[model samples]
Target: MTKTKKPEFRPNDFVVYPAHGVGKILSIEEQVIAGMSLELFVISFEKDKMTLRVPTNRATEIGMRSLSSPDVVMKALETLKGKARVKRAMWSRRAQEYEQKINSGDLMAIAEVVRDLHRADDQREQSYSERQLYEAALERLTREVAAVSGVDEAGAQKKVDEVLVGRAA
Candidate 1:
């Protein structure tokens, strides 16, 4: 059988972990466990102040990946400009689905959640849980956008807001 080559990611490279947002690779380490040598990627999330150790072999399986490309980011922003589709389902059910989408590490899916939950200044306010979910998804999307665009979080947020507001107008 032929062997498949493992994906190579280097130290100081920015990566996205599905459950988390953008993080930088601090180092790659190897350790012996149960008589087996395992390699790991040591990633640090500055916003959350958390470090994650992911097995090198399982990175793809776990959806760990490099930052989204400019084209992908443009598509995600386009997704934000689309009309919101709030299902008639119960809030709890919808919330769970939104959470799943945000955690899926797909830029478009996260954009959908942000679009659906976004409220204009004059619109009715979001419920506490709804607000929480909106912020979480927004944060995730913005963090990646910021990294990919070489902008600060606030600047990325403004770019996202411009799209959302333009769509609403």
Candidate 2:
């Protein structure tokens, strides 16, 4: 049988794992398990202080991806500037949808959640659950924005806040 090539991610590269936010590739290791050789990508998440090992073959299937391009990052930031589109559905349903978007590792979807859940100074405060989801989405989006834009996390957050402020004005 011909062996397939492994995924192209390398050490020191920033990647997004759908359920997690941004992580840096720590190393690639080969191991023998069940008498079969397996290649794994060891990733470290600074925010969570967690390390994860993903099989090379499963990286793409599991939605592990490189940082978004500058163009895509810009688009996501633009998404933040758009008006929020909160639905009239029940809170539970909206929360579920928001959770999915945040975990999908799609920058724009996370931005949408952040935009919809963000409350301006003049607007009504968000419910506890709303605030939780908003913070989760914001964290995910900001991490990616930081990685793609080559800025620190705080700077990325400030940029997002600036965009939201402009939108609110």
- Every candidate's lDDT: 0.92, 0.92
Segments of candidate 1 deviating more than 4 angstroms: 1-4
- Please report how far candidate 1 places residue 165 from its true position, in Å: 1.8
lDDT by residue for model 2 over 83-165, one digit each (tens)?
Answer: 89989999999999999999999998999999899889988888899999999999999999999989999999999999988
RMSD of 1: 1.7
User: What's each prediction's TM-score?
Assistant: 0.94, 0.95
Give candidate 2 misplaced runs (Cα > 4 Å): none
RMSD, one per candidate, in order: 1.7, 1.3
lDDT of 1 at 118: 91
For model 2 the TM-score comes to 0.95
